[model samples]
Structure formats: structure tokens, C-alpha cells
Target: MKLHYSPTSPYARKALAVAKHHGLAIELVASNPSQNPAHLLAVNPLCKIPSLETDDGVALNDSPIICEYLDHLGQGPKLFPAPGPARWRALALAALTDGILDAAVPRRGQQAFPMDEGRSAMVGRFQSAMSRTVDALEGVDLSGPLDIGKLGVVVALGYLDFRYAQEPWRPGHPKLEAFYAEQMKNPIFSETAPPPA
Candidate 1:
């Protein structure tokens, strides 16, 4: 299998971390994730990073879809819960984290390279969205006895550190900091953790 990705994207990292946790080593087709080539676009309509190329030539897009496929390839612990209320809960949390990340990237893009005033508003909106999302997570259980939802939290916070540590997030949210530290013990988390540029 091959995973098309950029090393810094949290969404791409999610799939990479899952692959590591499962002890799978895929060919890393790292690329400029924002620019889609014709061949890559042929694989994913969105031309998004973290597109998985199955051995048989099937292409899968979106981190969740790719993660699910990776889990199915193994007989080990499932990253997603089996069909039940818990499954949706875990999935929903993952989706929420992804949405927060989606909001943040554009703001970072604008502030780092603003073209107009509208980009500033977009950045502000995304930043507020992230703050609210973090606040909502205040009392959520972050202890992982090895669950997919927990992995979602780890990746989300780690991504913030990777891309926006200058914009400190955990100082006012010690619970989040503590939670992230706990999840950091996993080798995959550390191995895949992005460094500041």
C-alpha cells in the first residue's frame, strides 16, 4: 500500500499514525498536498492528501476512510469500535477533531500569507472555532486504554504543536496538556510527531 501525504498535515498524520500503530509500513508518496497533479486527481476527486493506494489499484480518499481500510487489513485491535453506540461516538469525535483541523489550516494559511482582509476574518472565525472546540473537551475522558477516539485527540493536539505552538494552546487548558502528554507515550505518536520548522 501507498499513502500520499505531506508530513505536516494532521489529517495525513492521522493515517500515518494509524499505520504505525498497526505495525504496517506503506510506501510514503509524500507530496505538496495543496497542489493536485492530474494523476493524483485521477485517484481522489478532492485531490486531498492521505489518499491510500491499495495493492490492487483502488484509491481511497479522506483520512477516516483510509484509516478504516488499514484496520480492516489487519486482525489486531480495531481503531474504530464495532457496530454499536460506541462506534458512532468514536467516529463522531474523530470527525469533530478533523473539522477543527480543517478550520485551523485556512487561518494559518491566511495569516502566514494573507491576500486580503477577508482572510483575516476567516482566520478569526477558525481560531474561535478551535477555542470553543477545546473548551468543549474540558471534561471529556482522555485516558486511552487504546481507543480510536483517544487517538483522535492525540493527533489534533499534536498537530497544533507541530504547526501552531507559537500560538500556544495548552497553557490555559492544562487538562488538555495533561491529556496530550499521557497519549504521547505511544511510540507511534512520538515517531510520527512533527517537529517545528
Candidate 2:
């Protein structure tokens, strides 16, 4: 499999971590979506990082979708549970984590431009969403073997730390802080951590 990725992309890191956990042999192809590299565009019209081109020649995009595909081919316990309440919970957690990324990623990009009234309002909204999600995560059961939900949490929190270090998410979210610390020790995370900010 060939993975189009950037070292700094949390989404790419999540996909890479899943592949590594599965012990899959993947060829990493450096791609900068901002530059619209033709190879990346061929796999993902969105020009997104973390796009996977399977050995059979099928192209897949989106971190969750790619992770699920990798999980299906993995040898050990599944990251995604079989259809049941457990699956729903894991998926729900994944959604929440993605929501955090949905806000944070663009918010960070917007910082490159001059801040104005509209940008300020959008930034505030993003911060509020992230804050509420972190608060909600504190009350959830984060203890478990490695799973998609846990992976999402780890990657999401890691992204916050990498890009928003000055605005820490650790304060008042002790459970998440501890959970993240423990998860970071896992090779799946430690090895795939985004290049230092």
C-alpha cells in the first residue's frame, strides 16, 4: 500500500499508527496537499493527506475509513468492534474526536491570515466546541485495550498539544490528561507522534 502523507498531519499519523499496529507494509509518499501534488490529487480529489492506495489499486481517503480498512486486514483484535453497542460507542467517540479536528485544523490554518471580527468569532466558536468535547471526554470510560476510539482520542489530544500548546487542554481534564499520558506510552502513538512543533 502507498500512503500519501505529511509528517505533521494528525490524520495521516492516525492512519499510519493503525497500519503499524496491524503490521502492514506501507510505502510512505510525502505529499503536500496545499501544493496539490498530482499524485495526491489522483488518489484524493480533495488533495488530502492520509489517502491510501491499496495494493489492488483502489484508492481510499479519510482517516476513519482508511483506519477501518486497515483494521479489517489486521491480524489481532479488531479496532472496530463487531456490530453491537460497543461498535456504536467506539464510533461515537471517533466522531467526537473528528469533530475536534474538524474545528482545530481549520482554526489553525486561519491563524496564518490577519485576525478580524469574523475570524475572531469563528475562533471563539472552535474553542468552545473543543472545550465542551474535552469536558465530555473526562466523564467517558477511556480505559480499554487499543481501539479506534482510543486512537482518535490520542491523536486528537496530541494535535491539540502540538498546535495549541499555549492553550493547553490539560487543565481541568485530569482523566483525559492521565489517559492521554498512558496512551502516549504505547508504541502505536509514541512512534507516530507528529514531528515536534
Question: CA RMSD for every model?
Answer: 1.8, 0.9
Q: Which residue pairs come into collision in candidate 2? A: none
Predict model 2's lDDT versus the native: 0.92
Tens-digit per-residue lDDT, 1-197, candidate 1 = 98888878788888888888889879998767567676668778887887999999999998888888887886668888889977887887887788778887766777657457776677788989987887777667665466667777888888777777787778778898888887788887888887666
TM-score of 2: 0.97
TM-score, per-candidate, Cα-based: 0.91, 0.97
For candidate 2, write residues 1-197 as lDDT tens digits: 99999989999998998988988899999999999999999889988988999999999999999999999999968999999998999999999999999999999989998899999999999989988998899999987777899889999999999999998999999999999999888898999998888
- Using lDDT as the measure, the top candidate is 2
Off by over 4 Å in 1: 112-115
Candidate 1: C-alpha RMSD to true structure equals 1.8
